[model samples]
Each structure stands twice: as C-alpha cells, then as structure tokens.
Target: MPVPTTRDKNPASILIEADKCSGCGLCVNVCKDFGLEIVNNKVHQSDKALFGCIACGHCMMVCPTDVIAIEGRTLSPVLMFELPEKSQAADYESLLAMFKRRRSIREFKNKAVEKEKIEKILEAAQTAPMGIPPSDVHVLVLENKKQVRLFAEDFSNYLKGLRWMSSRWFLALIRPFLKKENNEMMHDFVKPLFDVYVDDMDKGNNWINYDAPLAMYFYGSPYADPADPIIAATYAMLAGESLGLGTCMLGAVHPFIQNGKKASAFRERWGIKYPSREGLVVIFGYPAVHYQKGVKRTFAHIHRVS
Candidate 1:
C-alpha cells in the first residue's frame, strides 16, 4: 500500500516510454524502491517496488531521454525544469560567510520586505528535502507589520487563557512525568516565557514576534514527519539571509498552541489547518542594527564512531 498523507492516499502512476528507453540504467540506479527495471533492453515497471511509486520524480529527473512520466500524488512530468549550472551556485567561502554573518535579529527597521523578496524566500524554501514526497509542510504568511502585530496581540490574549499552565500547582502536578531537564525548563524558561509573552505584549511591547515586517509560520499536517516543517523553516531562514533580510525563529508560540480547545480555537482563528507535533514561526525584516563582527560557535559534542 502507498504511504498516506493528508493530501493523497494512493500511490503515483509510473509511465514508461519503452521505445525511447536507452537502457542506460540511470533511473534504475536512483530508484531505491526498484520500481523500474530493464527487460529486453527497455525500461519497464517492476513488481519489486516496496511502496509503489512515491512520486519522488527521481526516475523522471534522472532519465537520459524523456522516457518516464510520474503522475499523481501531486507530481507530474510537466513540473520538471532544467537544473541551474553548478557555477551559479555559491562556493564554500561565500556560503560560510553568509552563515557566519547571520544572527537572530529581533530589532527591525520600520520597513516592509518587498513582495518579490517574500516570494523568492518561499520559492527557495520549496526546494528543501522532505521525509516524503508531496511535502506536507504548510506555511502561513503574515505579509506586513500590521498583520504580524495583530497576530501577536491575539496570541497574547490567547496566552492569557493558558496562564494556568505556568502556575506552581500545574508545574508540581506535571513535574514527576517529565525528565529532569524538561522539568527544570518548564519551571524556569517556559513559565517565565509565558508570563513575558502575555505581560509584555499587554504593555505594548511586541516581543511575541518583535513586530517584524514579515512573518511565516511553517507547520505540517498530523501525518507529516515532525522535522518537515522545521527543515522548511530553516530553508526559509537561509533564503532570507541570502536576500539581505534579517530573520528570527520564534519557538515559544508553537508548543503553547498545540493541545487544547483554546489552542484549537486559536489555530482556527489563524487558519492553521492541523495540529502538528512540531512547527516554527520565522519573522523577517530589514534590520535596525548592524553587526560589527561575527561570533564563532561550536556544537555540544562531535564524536565519530570508532
């Protein structure tokens, strides 16, 4: 049976042009599912496929000739395009420079990101790899500062209803079920964060999203892998950096808006279609401040297997 997603239930249809096939085996080599094989020196659909055609489009993309057409599961041969030349891609130094110069920017100039730039950011994000084809990631875009601030205000109001979650009684009640680090974080970081988000926004301090000119909340359907939206959001962030826009990832809003009637209502109000296990909100804008130097950072640990 085909893997089910929120969008489609059936597997893709794989059509092969036997007359055009050169039997080069490029498509066969790339298709790990063993969906296609050479028979009598012509490509043919094989019964050995594990999940049928996932509509990954890898076979069609790799074919030397226009021999394969993948249809269904939101994919088609028409969707294929010419790949950009390798020279057009950024070199290691340029990529590292962009990464190093990037930082979490909350202070933004009172300027809106251009519509073209916003579209480009999304286009780049669509190229991100996913756990499955026909990626389940969805994005909610707040196109300007007014919408962003309004969303923050509404979210702050919603947080008011969830203030009980940060209470001492609730913490004590839930502490035993949580791991030590999680328990400490719930008491320390999360509790204070809830208060700060609700309280500060009430006083006209827009820390919820820092009043950025543009914001995109990337999330997935219940059927999606938890990392799908996160990976897409990261791609969007990198795209923002490439476009000279400042960006910041706001993690606090996601967990709060995930599990209850109040949360469901809040989601419905904002057009969020489903409650996913993980999601992220990224704000983008022209930065008000400029950095003089890039800071070096490191991972917690990096140990290769012996």
Candidate 2:
C-alpha cells in the first residue's frame, strides 16, 4: 500500500513479504509516525496514521527479516547497505584526538588536493544525517586554486558594490529595528569584516576563501532544513581532515550573497539554486604549516536538570 506525505504529492509504496515476515514487532515499535502496526501477528500499514508515512525507512531498516521495502520520494530499497561491524567503529578517544588535531587552516601549500580525496570527502558528506530522508542540499565545488581565487575576486567586487550597507548612517537607521546586540555586532564585527574583505582584496589579498586548492559551498533548497547543508559541510571538513588535508569553514560569503538583484545575478552565474536560510563554504588544501600543540576549548556552560 502507498501512503502520502505532506511534502510528496505521490504516496510512497511499502511492500511487505508475508512469507519472510518474522513478526518481531521491531518495525512497528520504531515507527514514530504510527504508520505501521501488527495485523493478525504480521506487520502491516496502520490505518490510524497521523500524517501518513513520511517514508523515513525506520520500518524497513529495523525489520530483521528484510520483509519490508520502501520506494518513492528519492528513497529505494536498493539503496540499503549492510551495517559495518562494531569492531570497525572508532573509539571516543580516537574521535577526540582527531577533533583536537583539526584546526581552521588559512595558510595552504602550493599543492592541489587530489580528485580522489575530494570525491571521498563528498561521499562521506553525503552520508551525514539530514532533517529529511532525502537531502535537499546542493554542493558547489571549486576544484582548483585559480577557480577559487576568481570566485573570491568576483565576490569581493560584489561586496564593494554594496559597501554603503556598512556605513555609519545605515547602521544608525537600522539600529532601532535590529536591537542593541545585533546593532553593536553590525558596527563592531560585520562592518569591519566587510571593510577588510573589500579593502584587502583591492590590494591582492584574499580574505574571502583564503585561496585554498579546493572549496565547496553547500547550500539548500527552499524546502530544505537550514541545518542540513551546515551538517553536510561539517562532515566534509572532518573527511578532509581524515584525508590529511587542511580545511577551514568560511561563513562570511553565504549571508552576503543571499539577497538583492545583484546577489541573484551572482547566484545565477554560479549555478547556486536558492537563497537558502543557511549555507557553508569549506576550503581544503595541503597544509603549509603544522602545529606542535593543540589548545583546549570549553563550552560556555552545561546545565543538568537532574
């Protein structure tokens, strides 16, 4: 039977093989949407579904007998993979060590990132969890240093065109609407960032993307969750680190290129899909320098209810 969702016009098809059904009830227990139930001691679609099936695949994934299959809305049973052995997984200490080794590397070597490494990074990023089952994230890959530099130059010029936004009069006009903290941020941080990006670029300095060998901009469609692209970009960064490539996340480019006619034109030229709520740019390259020690970092605070 097919169950429709709010996002998909056509319902997703769920097939249940009666002979292979073990009736363990794991699938029924894991289905958050109440889309599945036991019918005469066998798994079946529940008629009392809240919003029909979202096709999140919990039912299929949890089934011990592989009796259930889902198809539609970019999901397919064919895409299923065998879970890796527990022994193959990384320990907490190893993960923490890798995290400590990762730094925001702005300085890069003259060497270019291998194509295989870039592909592997993208592959790992695709495995990141998304807000929805089928990801709406899009990645724009600038393969080499030349391409990255060209884009940064173009972006700097674009920012220069809108320099009036950083003016004192403009900040004053928007202060009342923006509130105190944001107003101060505009004057203190954002205005200075704009100045440095534009001014430094004029003197052949690239503060935008840092002239890395490779850069990836991850963005989302109108239907995508704001965090989807960011999570994917983070995954890409971690993958780059694992591959021995230096990486840095550039957040300044996204918000600046999200509005106005000129921004739209720039997006069109670059094949960027939508003016996403959130996006991220990560640059990767061989390291030009190495650090002997890592600094410890802490959160602002951690609250415990208990």
| lDDT per residue as tens, model 2, 97-116 | 89999999999999999999
Alpha-carbon deviation at 74 in model 1, angstroms:
1.0
**Global lDDT of each candidate:** 0.93, 0.89
TM-scores of the models, in the order given: 0.98, 0.95
Tell me how many clashing residue pairs each candidate has: 0, 0
For model 2 the TM-score comes to: 0.95
The sequence of per-residue lDDT tens digits that candidate 1 reaches over residues 175-250 is: 9899999999999898999888998987899889999999999999988999999999999999999999999999
Off by over 4 Å in 1: none
Determine which window of 10 residues in candidate 2 has minimal summed lDDT.
Answer: 1-10
* lDDT value, residue 148 of candidate 2: 97
Which candidate should be chosen as best, given TM-score against the real structure? 1
